[model samples]
Target: MNILITGGSGFLGARLARTLLAQGSLALAGAPAQPIQRVVLVDRVAPPADLAADARVQPLLGDLGEQLAAGALPLADVQAVFHLAAAVSGECEADFDLGMRSNLDATRQLLEGCRRAGHAPVFVFSSSVAVFGDSPEQRLPEVIEDTTLPTPQNSYGIQKFIGEQLVADYTRKGFVQGRNVRLMTVSVRPGRPNGAASSFLSGMLREPLAGERARCPVAPETAVALSSPGNTVRGIIRASTASSTEWGARTAVNLPALTTTVGEMAQALERVAGKEATALIDWEPDAQIAKIITSWPSRFQPKRAQALGLAADESFEAILRDYVRENPQAVKLAVKG
Candidate 1:
């Protein structure tokens, strides 16, 4: 039950590590069983203070590509690997070489490491909705479904799609039990923004709630798919434990999402933190951001995800409520614009 989590310092990765730590402690104490025994966090930088202090947690700081190329990755005795490391859409789209090296090349190296390890760990990949291209003319299907062939229009999406294939092919050869979870846009994320093209999804809510100005890079009417941080973590963990027999032909399953407009999201912020919080948002659409955001699928019929017991925020309002609950100090009811 030794587990390795790459990209363990980023937003989603950090949260996942914390959740695993809590779960791991409970399991070690003879409570209900948890899937992990030893947990390792691998990233370019050390994990956050809280995670770094966990006794069961070990932080491995290094460049994954460099380490993999040098045959220096310490992959022995690892029973599961959560490959969550990758450059985001905005960054990847802006820098082609960096995207290829970080997203695709590094993934290939990791799969090779697993193959060479001789013990096939359960490999769970953190893929994204970016893998899917624009929705077809008819309202883009309600759910993206499991069988859709990826037609990625952006460099980031293309890289992720390639990674999915790598996982599937490696698994087919019995090198590892691979599961790729295509995460929806995670919203109301705690902390500062990263370079993701979808950063605005969390930005519009986070900044305003802090009584600071937040820009809505896309139009208010732009309908986009979303998931909460909690649900996204759950999907990743489920991928680790799900039996290969139950996985079937869908190597990559789209996680459930709540489809809503930017305007609706702002309204939810207003409901939770008052008009002052809503006032912090100023609409200033950037064409590049708009283009990327609009091209992404706005709706998905995640029936496969639902059947797999993956869940999502019931509505944007619930997402906001959860954000406020999770970060009450950073967000207050004060009417400061």
Candidate 2:
């Protein structure tokens, strides 16, 4: 079987690809576990060094929109598709056109191509917690439930919500075997900050630990739901490999997440790398970023995801320790105050 992974070069995408390759096989929606003959990484640029060199990986460069319009995206014989490509929240808010084109239009084009392919491929849409919007006056559930209707407050969130609906409808029509998972904010991201309003969530920990200064965009007390890259990739793989009958409903569910405050994260850093690493984080609050981030429900009653066997991390402290242990050369040794 062949798999197509949009945004396959990204942190989670790349990780998922490697995980799939390591496993050697994937379970197609209606089929038993089969060998993965190829993994087409559909992205705008070349895949990272490690992923590109693999014999099974095919790096197809350029945006999916242009690629599809030009009749370039390989849709036929693609047994599965993991839609992880998207314009991040900060970028979407900055450029509405880019967001609409990347987050909404690109997804539609992909689904349309899948419909045209004639094969009912397993489609996994990577949605976000941003789908749930909360505000000062209009408060959300303390722990967002699976039944809560999406109330997106920003362009990125709205786009993802629309994508979820698109995947569900497409699956309902039997055009594709679709499933969606509302991923939490992924933290301790490997690369530099991108345009996500929540980018600072990882930056505050990633940069400081790397001996570089980072700013905390939100207040110390403001909490955010997050998941580790390992856990996040596991969720994606599980969603992709699940049998159609096993999934039952096509709606997106919130993946389990660890909720922690900025202060707690910084404290975890201090515990791991010392007080000096804590000082590396500048306490500068950005209201615009905070508004968008805070609008996302931080606590989630992700019973559905847990029941599906998706796991959440224990705490922010554990996440930091894992990052440090995994990237020993990139991280600095703990310093005494």
Candidate 3:
């Protein structure tokens, strides 16, 4: 089986590639496991040296939008596709054209490519929790369910929701076997911050562990939904492999989330790495970022995802410890034993 992963150079994208490589095969729920022949990674930048060095990896570097419109992706032979690339929330808000081009236009072109391929490849679109927001028509419920209608309040969310609908329609037409998985904010990401409003969620924890100062754009008490990198990757894979009957409807599946406040995340950091690490996080609020981050619904039932055997992290502390363990070189502060 040949697979394709967009955003292949990113943290989660790279991690997912490593996971698939380690497993050595793609196993659909009802179908026999197929040994991975090659994994074509599509991204603007090349993937990590370790991932790129793998014999099975084929890195296709360039803008996804341009690549797709030119029919550049090796789609004809691809058996599975994980589309994870997008302009994040802050970037989308800052530049509407960037979001539309990268998120909406690129998605449409990719789907069109799949239709032309005529193979009906399993296409997994990575949606976002930002898709759920309060609108004048209806205030958000205390807990968002699988059946809740998405009322996107931001351009990023709007783009993701649109992508989800497109995937649904494409599947309905038998052009592709589409699966839409809505991911929560993945916390404790190892790397410098990106344009995502939720980047601070990972930054605060990551920078502090590195013995560097970090800014908290939202209030410590601000509630947010989070998932570990491991859990998020697993949920994405589950979405692609589940049988049609097991998957139920073609609607977007909300990946499980661990709901917690920024205050609690700080507490968890202290528990894992001691007060010195937590002290590095400065309470510097950016109102625009806070507004966007808070607009997303933090609580979720995710009945559909749970039924698919996906799960959230046990706790934020465990997530912190996992990050430190996985990226030892990134951690300079003394982690509690």
Candidate 4:
């Protein structure tokens, strides 16, 4: 089997690639596991050295939209596709054109490529919780259930929701076996922050533990829905591997979430790396960021995701500890003895 992962060099994309490489083969719909012959990673940047060194990894380095537009992506032979690349919330708000090109145009191109291939490959689209938002006309429920309608309040959210519809329509046409998974914010992400408004969720802990000061854009009481990287990868793979009967409806599956407030997260950081780490977080409110984050539903009843056998983090503290354990070098603060 040949696989394609867009945004293959990103944190989540790279992680998912490494996992697939480790497995060596994939079993789809109860069929025998098929050996992964090649994995084409499509991204503007290169992946980590270790992943690049893998014999199975074929790096397709460039802007995904450009490559797909130029007919450069070799999708004809691809048996599966994992679309994880997109302009994030902050970037979308800052530049609408870039968001349209990167998020909307690129997605349509990818689906078109799959349709032309005639293989009907298993396509997994990484959507976002941003798709659900509070609007003046329609207030969001306290707990977002599977049945709740998505009222995207921002460009990024609206774009993701549009992509979800595209995937669903493409699947209905038998162009691809599409599965859309609405991912919760992944907290405690390793490495430097990017354009995502939710980057602060990781930065608040990552920078602090790295012995540097960090900013908290939202108030302490602001709540969020989160998931760890491990849990997130699991959900992505399950979206593809699950049998057709088990996949249920074609609507997007809201990945499991661990809800917590900003204050509680700070407390968890204190418990993990002691008061020194917590002190490093500077609470500086930003109304723009607050409005965007607050609009997102912070609690969910992702019954579809649960039925797909996805699991959420036990607690925020556990998420923090997992980060500290997995990326020991990224943590400069000594764990309290």
Highest lDDT against the true fold, candidate: 4
Which portions of model 1 miss their true places by more than 4 Å? 25-35, 135-143, 335-337
Off by over 4 Å in 3: 135-137
Error of 1 at 155 (Å): 0.2
Off by over 4 Å in 2: 335-337
Q: How many clashing residue pairs are found in candidate 3?
A: 0
Tens-place lDDT digits, model 3, residues 59-152: 9999998888778899999999999999999999999999999999999999999999998999999999999887667789989999998989
Error of 1 at 244 (Å): 1.0
Order by lDDT, highest first: 4, 3, 2, 1
* Model 4: colliding residue pairs: none
Tens digits of per-residue lDDT, candidate 1, 1-337, equal: 6778899888888998888877763221123455666778889999999988877688888998887778776687777789999999999988999999999999999999999998877888999999877645433444466776677878999999999999999999989889889998999888999899999899888988787898998888998999999989988887776776656663698888888999999888887778888888999989999988888887777776777787777888887787877888987556323
- For candidate 3, the 10 contiguous residues with the lowest summed lDDT are 25-34
lDDT, model 3, position 58: 98
Q: What are the lDDT scores of the predictions, listed in order?
A: 0.83, 0.88, 0.92, 0.93
Clashing residue pairs found in predicted model 3: none
Worst 10 residues of 4 by lDDT: 24-33
Candidate 3 structure lDDT: 0.92
RMSD of each: 3.2, 1.6, 1.0, 0.9
C-alpha root-mean-square deviation, candidate 4: 0.9
- Between 2 and 4, whose TM-score is larger? 4
